[model samples]
Target: MSTPELQWFKSSYSSSNEPGDCVEVATTPTAVHIRDSKTPRTAQLKITPSAWARFLTTLPT
Candidate 1:
């Protein structure tokens, strides 16, 4: 999808030192935008806020 208007934000946990495997996120009124930090200009995977929350909760700390 064309995400020309989404204001993307990188995870605060991301470190410049660890450049690889980083992800960027954008929050819209209806959905969340997720993209690779290494390739910010590429297409993003959009999901609902509830789905995003569920996905995050499944991550191991």
Candidate 2:
């Protein structure tokens, strides 16, 4: 099945000048998508909203 195009964005913590250190994210009602900014066409990770929420809890604020 073909996937629809998603609107991707990077975190504010990611510096535009340091493209190599950036990660991009896209979200839908059912899932969240993550990909390396430097290689967008490469493999991407997809997770459910609940999983994404749990992941956020593990990160330092």
lDDT of each: 0.86, 0.93
Q: Please state the error at residue 61 of candidate 2 in Å.
A: 1.8
Model 2, range 3-44, lDDT digits (tens) per residue?
888999999898868878988999999999999988999999
TM-score of 2: 0.87
| Candidate 1 off by > 4 Å | 1-4
Global CA lDDT of candidate 2, please? 0.93
Q: Would you estimate the TM-scores of all the predictions?
A: 0.79, 0.87
Best by lDDT: 2
Model 1 scores a C-alpha lDDT of 0.86
Give candidate 2's total backbone clashes: 0
Q: List the residue pairs that clash in candidate 1.
A: none
Candidate 1 per-residue lDDT over residues 6-60, each given as its tens digit: 7877778888788867888989778998999888887889999999999999999
